[model samples]
Target: MNNNKILDVAIVGYGPVGQTLAILLGRMGYNVAVYERWQALYPLPRAVFHDHEIRRVFRMMGLENELEKVSQPSACYQWFNADWKVLVEIDWSAESISDGPFGYLFNQPSLEAILDRQAKAIGNVQVHQGWEVLGLSQNDATCELNMRKVEGDGAGETRTVQAKYVIGADGANSIVRRECGIEWHDLGFDEDWLVVDLQPNAGVELDVPDIGQWCNPARPTTMVPGGPGYRRWEFMRLPHESVEDLQSTEKVWQLLSPWVTPETASLVRHAVYKFRSRIAEHWQQGRILLAGDAAHLMPPFMGQGMCSGIRDAWNLSWRLDLVLKGICSEELLNNYTTERKPQIQAVIEASMAMGKVVCVADPQAAAERDAKFLSGQVPPLPPFPGLEQGLVFKTAKAGVSGSLGIHGAIERNDKVERFDDAFGRGFFLLSIGEDPLQSLDEKLLGELNQLGVRSVRLSKDGAPGTCRDVSGKYHQFFEENQLQAVLVRPDFYLYGGVSTHSEIPALVQSLCDEVSLKREPCAQLSQAKVAVR
Candidate 1:
């Protein structure tokens, strides 16, 4: 064996995003390292709003069952005004598909803890908590890095490392972005806010079950249940008013006094922050890249800030895995930033719009905005437009050529990674039970196994009537639900399918050039099922 080495990946700045990228790539058998500035973890609840793709990440990481334990079943939600007037009190349990409104609410610390533990569990990720990246640059061959332990009262020692690629998941003030000369567009957030998380009283009167929001013009509050009696109420600070002396218990009680008795509210985590919107002009330069808060920063209006970064992790994870495995050309990795940037920008715009509506304290604007929805002129916000739902995105820039329109932007994460017997390649296809990876001929199945294609045949357990599998595929029971097996590609796209078993190999070949997948599928596709549904 040649002693000389080829660098796989080096991830700079080991926060949640960096850590997540390391874990994801490590799972795909890529060599990864996470460099962090802090010697220890930050004990703050940085992110709270957990969404759909987040749940999918947990599922992919084999932590879904564990996450389901701490996860409180948040089904009922109420959108009310200061007068306790109901506007949109949606029982999320009713809407589980397409846009599954019912999800979990855990602080960023808890979620990060899970990801960190899982990354350690992968056993391949080397973590350097106190090491700060000195600098980075890349060429066509590989990327280089400089590092040192954060300086103490004495002086810090220096170190150097190299890798094939570098991901800068550092926060908004990213050093790697500076190295790459990446520009960012700023959405002015001259206004700032205070978040006062408090506990609820025993006999407080409100119709909200677990998660609720007070959408009053003055002092809007969101009641997010953390655990048993503790609830979070994020209060937007008024103009010219900084959250001075907010750490004191008295001040917290005073700010929340209008809503409830001071004795009833307990201040758990209280702080102030200026909300801003910014997306990095470019996400990658040569082998150096950026992710998470480093690439895009959005206000916490919809709680998708970290969620969007997690989405980035999901998108880039498999692609990097493919390149490292020599399954896909490294050029395909260039599509990583291309595919994700526009989507994240759209998310930022949506979040900014939501912030305007949610933070509108002016009576006239609030009434006009709320009245349209109250009067039923416009439908209640569809719980964040999703891939399956109607999606609108920002147009691509000049030279960003492709036949695929915004669909590529919105639907990128829609495809599932199914893992079963026939599938090879480290990534799973994520299929439904009914369309379980069809029992192919032994020779073909063995060939896939030899090629090491990782696949899964999911049986949607306890799915009522008929439902799609985890891979967004159809199984034997798919007829009732109008689904056939959706063949999800390694990059997590619906590669074809919606037909049946035997027919998959041909369909797979056309979608991904991994193997000799034929065009003519063996399984018969039901046309009547399509027309009926």
Candidate 2:
């Protein structure tokens, strides 16, 4: 309705990814507009899992309690052979760097509903449901989105909206991506599977493995939680089976009968999906960018599809904020692709590896795979990849840059809580047994202050301006790494760390350089002050 008013960001798509970007940007007091073709939530399950890192992001959004109520922590993910013998087990229940369970299971619709409410409640965000993005174009200054209303009283109405930036959080078949002429690089992993979501009847319990994969050559299968009050089963289609036949309700029941009878559970939804791996050749072009499924898609074997998209939102949010606020150059956005694409590609490859192990249809190959695992000859699962190549200090101590920053409980104001909750979250400069700011001169401190970097000191004595590390995790991390200070990015990844307090200034300066912070403005202000003096 307000075509003349330019927005800071225009988001195309109102799914979880779009909603997340809107909420993140809006919370920073940016003018954000979201356009979605659907008038209402899908109200069904799609993505059923998220990791603790995503949980940390939700906590930053102030949704920790709401998420806890609607989601359940995952159990070990076990893989079995044709005879139901355990081949490999992954502990998804273990604690992670985010100070929570490694993984969780929840209904996508419920999570989206929560995010939708949060996004709409923000005064600066406008959510236009049923408005389809027809096309988008961007120049040096701004991007314009052409949209048409497809629902409600103003059906078929067209309007154009302008914004400083445009994000395509649209799904795999993204119109915005197409409009930008972006192409997808297929990773060659493709398979057809029947996905069935079921809600067990109240007061009835079904005996089933919590979360597992049955690598049977006869009929490879997957069973996992479908959020709080549901269950999901996926059956890989054998080479001889047709997609149409596998999608029938009768066939779905047959595949599910081994776990639950129709009388004991109700079928909520059943469909055939082609799980594939794909990545956009480029995620950004001038003022237009892609996030979530629009940027990449991986097999659901590792349960990182939605998680990766949400990571894009989190990673892009801070960068966009800095650029919008004029604190950094637009070139900072290029890091979004460099930092995220490699991580996403790694995830796709990892997921494909898992899919290959479980998608075997040949009896002889399946037997060989089982033998390798059961004989204790197979290597363990590789650890998840971290930020490797973007916006991180390259010359810092080994194993510090690009790794996840440590978090632990701390005592503040006589109350013990998570470190982030106590110290606040932002670009953090943390030190052990000393004040990191003490090493910086007035000019460097002023620049860091202008960037809103929070300086915190962790100590055992609980000094006036320092937080007490109640959990000892901080002390252990500092002692083992022989580090006195570390600079953490907003997304909780280490930009770099210093072994001594004197190195703090260089570390801080590196961040300023990486973000391309314009010191000329600050220098001009300083000169003006001196001239007055």
Candidate 3:
């Protein structure tokens, strides 16, 4: 048995969530170790869609160009009845605060390949494939993982590794979550469905609705783009059919015959998936934490299954980074579940609501649903939830805290580009007409710098030390919200905002308190109303 050196972070799965965390932390120069039982990336397609928020995350990793080549923007999502009458339409092409298309469709394998290459390119990230984690134990100081090689030379060799924190991004059947004695809280949604992936042949363009759902009671189905060169269809398994019978090649062909044939398109893969809605009771226990599918699982109705997991990684990365740097205590991790669970729960409920609408198997119920939609009585889809609590500033006034911050084109150093590209990614103290740092005292300024908070002044006049808001988005945001200074977290969420620049120091001071930055109390300001939301 060999004992490996302690790592700053240990990831137990090599899926996109784990890979994302590795890349984010490794780029920050943290020593990250990733363990996976598989020797190579999964070749089959799984998740096929990601929203603009995820696009922003990938852009932060400098994968914008690479992702563009393999992805196609989603124009819209439509749901239709058996008669082909449109019941609902979601505009996925609408502009988002992330400054891009609302959603995108791409091949999961290609995306994983891109993330794999990026993760390996970072010298600080050590990816250990073919290593199966058999057991895990965590003390107050560190977590230890017991594992053995499952493939290649010295396959039977066992080793123990240590990490300050361990994250389980290992799929639904997660070993890390099990070891921590965490139980799942089932949200009462489970249904079996057959998923089929196809690649059309040359010059073959089958006639079908692009990204629409056929909500027919006889055979509820879903048709959408799988990626650049692929298409996917899903059929809800009727009660009369067995899962085994639905997955057969003959049945698959029959289900796909309406739109494609053996010559028009080639079958890539087909399987029956039991869409479930479940969330773990706890996401963290001691130094062991859960992320991605390990933390929550929802039906694929909204296509946020993978997106939600990536959000978990993004939320955890910064908190872990702060803890590893000793800038914050481990107690800061308590906010992990506090901030993410509610949003994920809301998503699960929404997806389940959609599933109920689409998975109707009765003739009368389907007719009623269609009539309600046709009558315009059905309500619109609920907006996606944001951070309503935990580590965010609360004010008596209606503030922009817990909302996603805006991003737009800005001109800096005679070059025009996206806000992130122009100023870089981190905690940003953005002021509209003046320098936000000027209000901060030396102590607060030093702490802000230590926290890697970047202060930027934006204006249309192009004054010295201020970037030009080329797109006028910054001006609009500040004006609409009646805010002069805004504090944005690394995840692009607004911590809080102030209507005046003098309150900037108070906002910064509140942040210092929230993040557990040890500093002496500065003189109080009358307008400073910083409390946790």
All candidates: TM-score: 0.75, 0.96, 0.95
Residues 323-350, candidate 2: write the lDDT tens digits: 9998888999987899999999999999
Candidate 3 TM-score over all chains jointly = 0.95
Across 256-283, the per-residue lDDT of candidate 1 in tens digits comes to 6766656655556778777899988888
Question: Whole-model Cα lDDT per candidate?
Answer: 0.60, 0.88, 0.89
Residue 225 deviation, candidate 3, in Å? 0.6
Q: Model 3: per-residue lDDT, tens digit, 79-113?
A: 99999999999999898878988999999999999
TM-score-wise, the better of 2 and 3 is 2
Cα lDDT of candidate 3 equals 0.89
Candidate 1 runs further than 4 Å off: 1-7, 90-101, 151-155, 187-190, 198-209, 227-229, 243-249, 258-266, 382-485, 490-493, 496-509, 513-533
What is the Cα-based lDDT of residue 416 in candidate 3? 86
> What is the Cα-based lDDT of residue 260 in candidate 1?
60
Sort the predicted structures by lDDT, highest score first: 3, 2, 1
What is the full ranking by TM-score, best candidate first?
A: 2, 3, 1
